[model samples]
Target: MTAALCLFLAAINIATLLAFWWDKDAARAARRRIPERNLLALALFGGTPAAFAARQMFRHKTRKQPFSTYLMVIAAAQAGGALGLALA
Candidate 1:
């Protein structure tokens, strides 16, 4: 189960990395078009790390007010979750 979860996370992370790497501008623009609820669903379903990583790497949505703060918090939580999963 853990291995599957890790694989899933890795896949998502890689996808996000590729998306950001290919065309950061397009990714940022695509993000704007997506609903916040959809993004939140992705984050909640273990994609937070990828989303946060993409935000940092692509410099997308990092300058806003509440969204920036929320993303930071979510990133921290995701790190904590990953650490806990590893330790368990």
Candidate 2:
């Protein structure tokens, strides 16, 4: 179970990173882009680390209003959840 969970998280993070990269590329090409909700959903589903890394690496969605705010909130909630688990 632990290994499976780790594998799932790894896959999701990779997918999230690829999504961010693709979205950035699409933006540069003026093409259809990934939706903000989808990105946030990825982050909410154990892809937060990749989301942050991709944001910094690609310089994507760094200063966007509400998106940044939403990301931060999600990060905080995840952190809190992890802390609670650790404590428990």
Number of clashing residue pairs in every model?
Answer: 0, 0
| C-alpha lDDT of residue 56 in model 2 | 99
Among all windows of 10 consecutive residues in model 2, the one with the lowest summed lDDT is: 1-10
Q: Could you give candidate 2's per-residue lDDT for residues 1-88 as a string of tens digits?
A: 3999999999999999999999999999999999999999999999999999999999999999899999999999999998999999
- What value does the lDDT take at residue 22 in candidate 1? 52
RMSD of candidate 2 to true structure, Å: 0.9
**lDDT of all predictions, in order shown?**
0.66, 0.97
Top-lDDT structure, candidate number: 2
lDDT of 1 by residue, 23-73 (tens): 566555664454445554566666776777777877866676776677667
